[model samples]
Target: MNAISDTGAAGFLARFAAMQGRLPGDSTLRLAAANAFRSLGLPGATRGRRVEAWKYTSLQALGGMSFRAGAATAPAAKGIVFVDGRFQSGTEKNFARFADRADFGELSWPDRDPMAALNTMLAEDGAIFQIPAGIDAGLVHLTHIGTDGASAHPRQTIRLGAGARMTLIETMSGSGCYLHNPVTEAHVADGALLTHIRIQADAPAAFHLATLYVAVAAGGTYDGFTLNTGARLTRTEIHASLNGPGAVAHLNGAQLLSGSQHADFTSVARHAAPKGTSRQTVKNVLAGQSRGVFQGRIEVARGAQGTDGYQMNRALLLSPDAEIDTKPELEIFADDVKCSHGATIGELDAEQIFYLRSRGIPDSEARAMLVRAFLAEALDPVTNDTARELLEDAVARWWEGQAA
Candidate 1:
């Protein structure tokens, strides 16, 4: 690595190590992760867009910040609560219900990525949601907040037993110049189902990086949806492994950005067993000088025959200066597998806009409607009524703010 990248890495490690005593979880693992990060260094910048994975998005915002550890507050299970890394009184019952479970961190998943390792070393506290067998876990709504100069790593884990079902809605928002790194691990057992909806609308001065790891067993299903309309620099990465036959993974997300904002969505779906299915559809609407990125990869193992995988990324550039970069990949070793991936970048339909304007609809409203309709492909998969409504409202707010 060069001197700039080295300085950033060294500073990050030194700060994290100094705060090791204050971070949550076992010290042994934390130290190990920190040590690993020291050797990996930071993911550097793109040399003339040579790095395909990070060609459109820049890490300068995250690298320039001087991050300090923040407290991981407990969450209260109310109708809807916005949390900013603080768990106080009046949330005891909800906190205990989530944290006191016996299988808090039982599942074994290796953290090989440098970003994951950094999260492990700096994570202060996290939320845990475990659903028992044959039961339906109700809605969980939370808003994670961040403050200036405070770097918070909030870890969350959701585990479902056989025949279990649940829905989670988490919104990330905050003010000031902070870096929020959130790590989530979800395990779905045989015949179980889980729906995860995440909304990111943070302060434009903030930096957000989140990584999610999901494992699905036989007859299991995992559906994840993300709506990104915030942060100066944001990256949402998800990795799903279909570990057993008949497992299905569907990942969908939309990124609506304006001004100088940057958002990246990267996902990898692995089929480790036969008869597994994975689907991904992501949409990006960019305006002003914003930039959006999507990197999706699907992998089919040697013996994982009868696998079905599909991926599509579509971006609408609302401004001349706006940009979008999409890289869709497929690595199939199975002979009997079917997989396809593609991306399209275009502008708003001039004819449609003209027709809508001639019909007495304002241009702004017409464009917003078109954007919403375009994004519905990714959002419509969210079956939970409340979560869908909330996401729609968030998208509306973002449009209203960015409307021309």
Candidate 2:
């Protein structure tokens, strides 16, 4: 099989079909993936509105742009860039926790091309960050910049070895008319702890789609916080699997939408082993004619006793034109497990505003304060004070502009 011949749409379909034969030898999984791709290949007219709970932030409004290959510019910092599914050489840094050549070499799939798997399974070119065993480290920053008129798909993979601890910070910003499709996969080994923070501030003409997948081993911990403030259309998905007993996962996210922009945050947490726990909180502020969506699901497998999970999603509509849709779900097969989910959508509290105004606070300032307070909950879990402060500042700046 000539893998290079599989480029573009036809190439993708052929390669995907070939890879389907080699995947875990699971016919059901192959059919599921094929069906997913077939659904994805439909025309806009046929697809129309999205029926998925997490797809309330529609990408169809962005017109007919599809993911294509292109050249990515030189990154300003230490990170990999993939333009149109091609990898570009980035500057090697001594300070950055880099993935060595051996790391890439070890990722081999028998009877299947790794590169093809990466291209078909992943949506973009991405870098990998690995925290070796016994390495307790500080934050590692990942910055993604998208130039105008180019579509880029980047995929990232991170692995944390036993007893390792680290923080990952991602900042995605771009301008011009383009699409950024990114996917990230993370593995937290036994006794490892990982803190992840993401910031998305793309241009108004940009369409961004991101998915993060995480696997936690026994005694591992995974914590994440995300803030999305830009892009005409953006969707972020986080999926985590608790594969080991005593694993823990926590997720927090906030989206600030204005103008005609749309943002969606969807997450799924699955507990496959005993004594695992997960919690998630999501917040959204919608103004102007913008829209936001939050769909979260927690699943506890049968016989996975001692599993605990909780999820909450809340939205604030600042204008009559603003809209929000939320769906919180739980699928528990274990009778001994505990799982719950809650969702709320409403306007600001009128009584609180009146009380603030009576206290001599200007209406604008009072409103901004209330909004800030509402957003602070998501920022509470950020371990890096600088990152937390930066997020706070960004929220404040956006709210101030809204007030003005």
Candidate 3:
């Protein structure tokens, strides 16, 4: 593969080829991923300016950078740290109950060769987290700190044993001039419950691409929420499989962007077994010249009878220059399954603004209040009160900054 300038199709192909070779191994899944990358190819001449239903955010402004491995240092607390895709070890005296392995060999993926596929496609290094059966681990904090002067890739895999429950909090923050491409794979066994909270606060010069893949077993539950408040360009992808009967998944995400920043949230949930259920909600707030995108799809296998799925995406634009694109889809083959999707894009309501002003509230505060109310629908799924409060505070701070 020859290196081409960033603008051409050949350049994109060459980059993909290089990633494939640098990946951990070669597998059928890897080949499929390579094919998908090829299909996406490169952005056209109007790459960022074009309006695509699935791509509301633009990555044109993010310059490419080389990825380098980081040293293995100790983490500050008990949680694990991955800096530039390598594990750093230091323990905060309070750190306890979290599992970490420098090696990916200990992790297991039965449905696919996620390690090889992700490595080849993403060309980044990450870590694995495991929780044993019957353990009610309160909260496992995973932090990605990018100290690398340039871009980096970090991948993670989390496994929860049967009858176990855990809460995972992920914080992405760093100062640098590069992109952060992180992929996380999660497995929840039978009767297990896993809650995931992701907060991203990358620098203005940072570009981010994060992916989460989840598998839920019989009677298992998976709940996730993402708050994207930082970065010049950020995209998060969630792909889940309802692999067993009575499995349930609830996915919610919110993005607050201003200036020239952009964020994209995309997800796909598949029902492979009967009696599975899934619900998805995404809310976005765009201001200045920023852009936001949300794309969600639900698929019911041919034999997946009694499947139930629902999806909704809503966007609020605060400036004429801002843009939003939303797409919600449902593909059901089973006759007994129930699935539906809806999307809405609009500005603040004049009636509500007048109502607030009539009650002596200022315009800026009233707008911020309404925006927070609009977002509550998505934030309600966060099960932890403290975590939820933190998320709300993040949203409030972002809105206050916009108002100022």
lDDT of all predictions, in order shown? 0.78, 0.70, 0.71
Residue range 266-308, candidate 1, lDDT tens digits? 9999999999999898999999999999999999999999999
Best by TM-score: 1
lDDT of 2 by residue, 1-24 (tens): 434353333344554565454433
**lDDT measured at residue 64 in model 1 versus the true structure, 0 to 100:** 51
Candidate 3 global CA lDDT score: 0.71
Residue by residue across 1-404, what tens digits does model 3's lDDT show? 34345432334345555555555533454567555544443223223333353345544443243333344343464466666565565343223221233233322231233223333454445666667887777776777776544445565677888988888887777776555767677889999999989988777777677767889999899988899998888888788899999899988888999998878888889999999989888888888999888889898999989998989888888899999877788888899988888988999999999999999999988987888888776687787986787788778778778778
Error of 3 at 91 (Å): 5.0
Q: Which whole-number lDDT from 0 to 100 does residue 75 have in model 2?
A: 51
Runs with alpha carbons beyond 4 Å of true place in candidate 1:
1-7, 45-56, 71-111
Model 2 per-residue lDDT at 99: 21
In candidate 1, position 261 carries an lDDT of: 89
- Better by lDDT, candidate 3 or 1: 1
Where does model 3 exceed 4 Å of error? 1-78, 90-125
Candidate 1 yields a Cα-based lDDT of 0.78
